[model samples]
Target chain A: MSFHEKSNLAVLALLTLVFGVYFLWLMPQMAVADPLPPPAAVAGVLIPFVLCLVVLIGVVHLVFKLRDLKEKGEADERDRLIETRAEARAGFMLALGVFGALTLLLAGAAPFWIANALLGALVLAELVKGVLRAIAYRRS
Target chain B: MGKGKTRIANSIREQRFHAGEMTQQQLADAVGVTRQTVIAMEQGRYSPSLEVAFRVARVFGKPLEEVFSYEDEA
Candidate 1:
């Protein structure tokens, strides 16, 4: 697999772990708390998100150092093909997410919810596409 | 994805060889693309944009037709 593809995989795994921890397991548990109060502040989640970003950057960079950049030739025909397909798939995912965002807006959803939802969808689509590309490259 | 065929494959290949067995990287640097893009052109796996194609021909000091020819099979 190309270095780019490997990084993409790492990013997807990072996102999945973060999402599971914050959304599924932790958020649910928080909602069940006694006399559950609203979130401490809008910025409370910023720390975790920043930490996740740092972890992602550190992990991928450590995994694929510049020493691996010396692959004798230009990425061969196979690499090009893989890149083309990966890019196309990712583009479609973005388009789909954007389309969903449009529908929600047309339905008169709250502006804040519409914007945040669209952003989340974009992030998720990117995560899925990265994972898909990495898996495909590894298999090949 | 196969939109248009390259017409000057042979000429481009020959010029690259004549210019001291020019490596793809060297040509790519001259033509303003990544080495991978140059390799694609050399192998006939891609058809570059007209601007790039013109740049490539100019690099060889040849008319565009001198480097490329049309072939139905390709």
Candidate 2:
């Protein structure tokens, strides 16, 4: 696989693992009795910590890959074009997701639901972006 | 911008072979693209931009038309 493809896979895996684990941990708490836990108390600290760890791992992997392949010919015109297109698609999804979240809030959903909806939308957007990137690499 | 089909085909593979059995990586470096991009072009899976197409032809010391051809699907 190309380096960019490998990088994309690693990022997708990291995002999935980190957020998947967070959601699993939050599930029981989310079901707790009324007066829902403050979003910060429940996930704020853990989210940042886990995200930092995942980002660190990705950066380290990329550094090593770059060192191993000094002449990696990183991200030429075609690669850049593919990435731009993928991000544009992902951005559209993200906008729609946020708008949906706002609609839910306006319709009187709990703050907890609104927050989770936003998070879900963010994750889905990133996932879509990563998947589209992988497809572009393979097909184009 | 569309996917799954291309109107351009190229003989980059044959040209690379003639040029001292050049590797894709080397050609990509010379043409300012990734090796995978060169592979895609050779397989007729991805069409390069005009700029990249000209660069590839220049790398091979040939004319753009000599390296790539247009096949209208109309």
Candidate 3:
């Protein structure tokens, strides 16, 4: 796998874990009836997010370890071709998310709500495609 | 662009191999592609441009039809 694909995979994993924690633990515990838990940043969430970020950065370096400060020939023709195609697909995902959000805004949704919705959708699509690309590259 | 059973001409590569082996990377270098690209072509993961295809034949001092062939698949 190329560095581009590896970075995408790490980001996808991080997004899923963080969002899953939000839905399963933080939001549910806050919405519980008995005792409204004080909002606290879970060490669990923070740790994994930070760790994933650090590891992603590390992997990016590892992927480009050779070459130079001016890294040429880090990727061959096939890598470049695959990357271009993947980016085009990811861009379509972003565009679709933005279009849906704009439709909501036109229907009189709160501007902030629309913005948040758009951001969430974009992140989800980005994560999913990153994962799919990783799979596609392997299968290819 | 299309994926199907295609016949590949392996003879030019065979002719280039005086020692019975020619590294894919060496041909890729002469054809201005990466070794990964060569692997893709060999594995049918990608198809090269017409110019690159011709260059690949030239690298082995063979004609294009001798380097690649066409086949119909069901």
Q: Indicate which candidate wins on lDDT.
A: 2
Off by over 4 Å in 1: A1-43, A54-119, A128-140, B1-11
lDDT by residue (tens digit), candidate 1, B14-42: 79999889988788778766665575566
What would the per-residue lDDT of candidate 3 be over residues A52-85, giving only the tens digit for each residue?
Answer: 6577657656656553333334565556666666
The true-versus-predicted C-alpha distance at residue A70 of model 2, in Å, is 2.0
Question: What is the Å distance of residue B52 in model 3 from its true position?
Answer: 2.2
- Per-prediction DockQ comes to 0.07, 0.64, 0.30
**Candidate 2 CAPRI grade:** medium
The DockQ-derived docking category for candidate 3 is acceptable
Clashes of 2: 0
Distance (Å) between predicted and true CA of A99, model 3? 2.2
TM-score of 2: 0.88
- Please write out the lDDT profile of model 2 over residues A76-118, one tens digit for every residue: 7777888899999999889988999999989998777778778
Could you give the DockQ of candidate 1? 0.07
lDDT of 2 at A19: 76
